[model samples]
Target: MPETVTPLGDGPGSEPGGTPGGTPQPPRGGRGRRTALIAAAVAVVAAVAVVGALGLGGGDGGTGAPPRSGSLVPVTRTTLTERTEVDGELGYGKEIPLPVRATGTVTWLPRPGAAAGRGDTLLRVDDRPVVLLYGALPMYRDLGLTAARPATPAESAPPPAGPGAPAKPSGTAAPRQSAPASPRQSAREVKGMDVLQFETNLAALGHTGFTVDETFTARTAEAVKRWQGSLGLPRTGRVGVGDVIYAGGRIRVGHAGVRVGSAAAENALTYTSTSRKVVVNASAADASWAVRGTAVRVTLPSGTTVKGVVASVGKQATAASEGGGKDGSEQGGAATVPVTVTIGDQRALGRLESGPVTVAYVGREVKDVLAVPVAALVALAEGGHGLETADGAFVAVRTGLFADGKVEVSGRGVREGLRVRIPE
Candidate 1:
């Protein structure tokens, strides 16, 4: 058999005798490259499978290994204050119109920022001072003294003519009894709710000896005389319609509609509280959080921050109209209510008249409580949310206030410095 074996003819790279050139070569380079590509593909598939398993298992590898270092967050003990910021306007509380009942040329007017106290002259019409008085009632009539009258006709008339008196002359009319004049007949007649207001304010102004009632009496006239005398006016014991202006309280002139020499009509001036406050028109839903006495932070236009307290929360909601549809149909808007906030530091407002401001209404507060990023909370199959531990374990937790991207959490194993996992 060995003697019968024959050598095969070689191709291009091999010599015929096949001594030194080369034996038929296999495709080593191509095979090696193909094997490498297959191995690379297998590795990629394995890695993708591992990531898929981790994701499916809720941030935990099926092997029960801890999460990646970047996904761990440590529980912290800190104060978390929940707050909401709302747009507000920095200025006096509310604008109140000061209407002038006296029709005449405006003689004098207070400067826009002038602070007028009760009994202070707000403005002058026809050279008569229109004084400011704190009262809830509007002055509608003059205040003056009225003479007292008999309570009964019998008391007012003389005893029936003596029966013994000669019979009335035939066709002779008995002495005509002049009908008593009505209280309104006198030029000094004074009667109205305005009289009650005048008496109230006079009492507040240190004037005494007057009952605060709707009826004007001699005692009321005395008080009026005292008030008039204090103002350097004649003691006429009377108050004309334009003599006083009623308002909720002392006011700072906000605007003057009528200048000197201008006719004083209904709305002659606008005034507001002298103290600076922030007014927020909050949506009805958000109004509940803006309770009176709630602490707040006010950011002025100049980037200044000041402490404040909610002074009042409006009970009534006001509807705001956005606009009409293209066909002129009405398009309704949100209902909002006003919230008044008073600044604790008035000096910080400086010379700013009115500007847009931001009011952060502080809500629930968690002090020195265990808290974690909201992202760290996980929904457990059992019921409530839980905090995932570093070891792929979830500790049941009771959640409290949520604020500023953090949540107040308490549980068996959730304490400060305990690292929790946040799914990436």
Candidate 2:
């Protein structure tokens, strides 16, 4: 049976002045159950846990050495940590749905996992490409000339040929050739940051002829025409609603929801950032444990450890369901909160796209304290836990943080470097 509290008012037995160590007593009955602050590692935990004198030194009462077989382990002062590890998933962060603003049949789609950069075609609707532009604003209105004005005969006349091309027969009715000013240049123009966004893409695509500003000019329209022609679309100087879409930067296709023959509708595809990230579904009770911006460690599939930080914590809770359809549905599984983690180094993850990973969350920490291998702790005869001195004395100790293979200990008699007996 577990030992009765000896006399160590703080724990079991103790001599005067609060120092543990009264008289040793052999276990009086069968082994009893006791909750131990033991580590979960197989190498650290023993098959059977013994208590009292029989489990420790096996001596009568006061002795200079153990009466039975054992080894001496000294108490050491060190820092201990409380850590909790949970399963995590590796991926390209969350997917953002892309709305198809054009009205046409989906004619083409890039393969999933393909990446699209600024000014690149994300999808082709009715054979017209819906190009991707870099910007925070979405394409909600026409950003170029709304309509082109009718041209006069003089304005319609062509300019003189360049030096490389044959001269227009010495201008023999070259119609007094002269470059006509763009008609829309004098008319009102579309204005806003959206205009600047399109112009930015236009300049990146090498179709620059206009300044990058918030207002779309006739030159901007000309640039748009050139860009459209390169994509095999009609050279309409005006950009239509289905002409393009905008995002922050390069994105990878996550999934294609529209088929080549299907009618194009909203949410035509999904895209995610090009970088790899980690997602963890933590237990709901761990909300406080996984605070935002908390630093953590992740173990990759190759056993390589990488540093990570908690990028975001979700407030909503979700849980898996247990199937019991007809008979009667049962309660759902434990609720969990979603957490996102970011890794700074791309080379560390290598070419891994998605897989399972382990995340370690640091909890409480105890500094500069006396501790010993958890295996050395013994249940007191009366109640509580204590450690055995190498000299065959029982020192009732109050336990603190438990981590690694050691447990923090403190008591009147417990001191650093003090030898404790470990049953072989």
Candidate 3:
């Protein structure tokens, strides 16, 4: 059984041993009131002391201090655009390695930074000049002449002396003109898309007669002979395997890999399209912002700002090595996707070569919306969140999009120019 407890202030109709209630004698009116007043005063004093000890009173300089009042910030309506800046490179876009088809000692090379157009001489191998042509098909076989019967001396001779032909001057023998030696012919006979490339190049160079096709016909041989003759080469009606380099367009030599005496090999030079462009490697997370056709701002090294548009975005991501580690390994690396941006105003770049640049990608936007500092929001004891009014009253609010240190807010009492407190 639990022990019986008695209250400190218990006073009642008395019973034997204070076990039961009975009619109790009443004290003098004045003294009874005095005792009651003194007990009440003591209880009040003890309550104050306990509150102070627990640091729950406003008078305490600790956690018990009065609520702090924060400064007010006015809500405003404006247009907000999410923008991100990333590092980029300004140049002629990606570098394409030029493969050499002919193998020999590098006899001569175009000067660095030179621009070579279709049908222009790009370099020389063993004293044989390799020409640059505009085409996607690579040269795979030697272009040569088809064997044909030699012209008879009578057919080659100037009109046979006819009975009525003008008498030759005395001592002036008819100049003998031997038909040009049969154009040189190659043993390696080939026909494919490479032949079509040759025909296209011949046509582009103003030599036309044969149809542009995969077959190497006698007409193509004749055209080749004409082209060779124009170039002051032996009109052999033949082209060697290393006669031409096929490219997409005019190529600007960015770098040379072979020297005067180096053996000609693949990737003898690196070149790019003449058009300038900007390339940016962006994190995969930001790939969505690099959609093609999106306008952007490019900050050049000279501090010039030019408008540009997204040209292309890579579909795949790749690891990009950043800083070098102590053990000579990649450090702080991340996967990135390539994005190409084309400048709208090409002249603005001036004579700037390849260099570091900055590109800004504009993202989502919110317009004509009421927004407040993100710090203005406060949690309420009653649940949910609210903003403190100028008069220290808490008004509940609902939040929407959050961006740029500001958040969209709405509530019954929220309005434009309404000041809301922000924590310092």
Candidate 4:
């Protein structure tokens, strides 16, 4: 039989734990239930205390797992201190655009885009202008002076026999021969011949105003002036060898419907610009970072290395060359003021033709400073952040020089040997 349970101050025939009045006996089962409830409550309290200490009860004020940390290594002491960071591009300092020197058919000795040296022949003139002169007295003299003298009719006279002596006509004067014809010379005769020759020569040209054998009179000079005006020249009547002459600008040769002919028109040579000046302007923000004489390096299409130096720093802000400027400074006005960098070696010019490149500048260096990856430093809300301590809590830290992906952090709360968590 199970042990019988008893209530305090209760008799066998009375209610369990009842006062002394005669009452019916309470059930042993009720007494046993009260005792069992008390025991179970005590066991539950004990279990909760164990769980709380073990951190299983999350609200028990224990941080679940320690934050992860990475080891730090010593960096070369000479690498710290950089005040400014800037981006820059490469460009040319000086350039020359070769322009058209004379007007004629376009021909290039070295095909377009070819390299040229000083004194290299670029092109040749196709025709040489020529002049011819002639005398005019021959025809005029024959019509006037020579024909003016009338021949006297000879009187009929018997001819003397050659073999046997024959009687000659009495009173027959010997026929007088006209004096040898004297050539009459005159400016008009000479001038007329010149006019004819000039017309013939002018026809040989491309219907241009210039002509050979043309009387080089005041009219000729005026015509030359008109030609000069059309060609954009100073209207000077005289021309020398190699002087530029143009029938009209934009005149092309060897085109459709134009017969190819050798004339003074072909002699006109035109000069055109094959190259130009190009420069790359840098931003003013880079001036302080990029000091004068800062060395820059670049590579060419041929894998050739080129060197350059910082030549100037902009004192004011101005529009940039590449994409204009920033803010409301206007389309071209907003560019960062210029910082000019000239190439140190001329050989580098051969590789550059006014294009893009890379530039770098060095800044101040520091020594023997405690540093870590910039990622490890957590900026504090007040002024800076903190780093994780071995205890899993962040400690306030003061930071110094920041450069090359590293920063100098120091404070009483942080030590060189302290393990700090770097937030991923």
Q: TM-score, each model?
A: 0.58, 0.64, 0.57, 0.37
Instruction: List the candidate numbers ranked by lDDT, top first.
Output: 2, 1, 3, 4
Count the clashes in each prediction. Answer: 0, 12, 1, 23
Report the error of model 2 at residue 338, Å.
2.6
Q: What Cα-based lDDT does every candidate model obtain?
A: 0.77, 0.78, 0.76, 0.46
Q: How accurate is candidate 2 locally (lDDT)?
A: 0.78
Q: Which stretches of candidate 3 lie over 4 Å from their true place?
A: 1-80, 145-191, 314-332, 367-424
RMSD in Å for all candidates = 11.6, 18.9, 15.8, 22.3
Which 10-residue window of candidate 4 scores lowest in summed lDDT? 137-146
Model 3 steric clash pairs: 13-22
In model 1, the Cα lDDT at residue 3 comes to: 75
- Writing each residue's lDDT as its tens digit, candidate 2 over 1-424 gives 9976654535555534364555544444423322222344432423223334533443223233333457889999999988877778999988888867989899898999999998788988888888888888888887666545667878765665687987557637635445655655446688888888788888988999799999888888888888878888788788887788888999998788778889887778899998888998777865687878899999999999899999898889988345311222332265778899999997999989999998888888899999999998877665577777766677778999999889999988788899987866
- Stretches off by above 4 angstroms in model 2 are 1-63, 66-78, 147-184, 204-209, 229-235, 300-304, 323-332, 375-396, 413-424
- Model 2: weakest 10-residue lDDT segment is 323-332
- Write the candidate numbers in order of decreasing TM-score: 2, 1, 3, 4
Error of 2 at 355 (Å): 3.8
TM-score of 3: 0.57
lDDT of 4 by residue, 168-259 (tens): 68999977765654433211222346344333433433234644453544444456566446445566554433332222112212112112
- Specify the highest-lDDT model's number: 2
